[model samples]
Target: MNRFLVLPLALPMVALAAEPAGQATTPLAGSDMAGQLGQLLLGLLLVIGLIFLLAWLLRRVQQLAPRGGQVIKLLASQSLGPRDRLVLVQVGNEQILLGLSAGRITPLHVLKEPVHLADAEPATPEFAQRLMELLGKDQKDKS
Candidate 1:
């Protein structure tokens, strides 16, 4: 009984081993280590090529259309609290209330002087330039 059971298991293994030695030693195309290595390298190169292509496309698109105001709200919302600086100037009976924050501040306009608040424009080129210069100076100072 034991011999019969052992024969069934051993016979298959013996038959497997009886195949030609050359056939057993031969490697399949898929199993070739160098082929696998080359395939892996090719896949990596393909990924890198795709990344460079995307970058080139993005650069071309950017060149074709120059865009601005991508993050105006982000920049405008940086200051959490009251973003505007309020200045109260009392000249005689009348009181001048001025708000200076972000795009409101200027270089030439004397914030120290107590002037009338009736004459004030929200959008001024001179004001914007002065504000830009002031912001640049502030950034430089911080850095």
Candidate 2:
């Protein structure tokens, strides 16, 4: 068994060593190495691009997830600690105060009269508007 395995492996090495003296190694060895390196880099770039595509698809899928209905609306949230928060929620005519911590949500109280917070600014500006604002600031700063 050992001889059979040894012979099979040795035969290839022996054949490789038996090349004719007149036929030296190919002169395009360097070019072959460069081609192989380029092929490797292209494969790496393709894999990275595929990963980014998958990540973008995942974000879009999550954003498009169905929310059922707007039965419950969050009024406001205040962070008490790093992992704890007080959340005010409204459902129909009822308002609830809830305490939220890691892995648990506890109802703190039920408001007889609903507490409404002051409304914040309207919807945020898109990328173009934000970019124009930044450019205007830069121009003003340079003046």
Candidate 3:
């Protein structure tokens, strides 16, 4: 009776140990490892490509959106001092000149007739150009 009980348990253990001699027990073969690595790289590249595609689409959509017909338009701005500015803004048909200091905005004037602005050319020079002209005038005066 002892011999019969031991044989029953030993038979299952022997079967579990008996693996086929031709097959490998480990699953990581060279081809399998290469294929898995390829799949991982492809997935990473797809996620990166999708992010760039979404960003490009967002930029295109923003460009297509309407930008005209705004109520307030900045016609021109000039730096009055280090921390002060004079701004000309057009609100609908009325043109307003505003003085902007460090902490306050004062309305300087409102034009009864809107200034006729040329379509292609601006009346005022750029800040950099104006600054260069002032510097040149100062050098000439010193000479």
Which candidate comes out best when scored by TM-score? 2
Query: Which 10 consecutive positions of candidate 3 have the poorest summed lDDT?
Result: 19-28
Residue 72 accuracy (lDDT) in model 3: 88
How far off is model 3, as Cα RMSD? Answer: 9.8
**Which candidate number has the best lDDT?**
3
- Per-residue lDDT tens digits for candidate 2, residues 94-139, read 9999999999999999999988666753234458888998999999
Q: Which regions in candidate 3 have their CA more than 4 angstroms from the true location?
A: 1-48, 122-143
lDDT of 3 by residue, 65-93 (tens): 88795788888888989999998999999
Error of 1 at 80 (Å): 2.0
TM-scores, one per candidate: 0.32, 0.55, 0.49
Local accuracy by lDDT, each model: 0.61, 0.86, 0.87
Model 1's alpha-carbon lDDT is 0.61
Report the error of model 3 at residue 46, Å.
5.0
TM-score of 3: 0.49
Put down candidate 1 lDDT per residue, 15-120, tens digits, no spaces: 8788866575776745687888999999999999999999999989988884543332111112335775544434444444544677775322323554433344
Write down the worst ten-residue block by lDDT for model 2: 117-126
Off by over 4 Å in 2: 1-13, 16-25, 66-71, 91-93, 102-104, 118-143
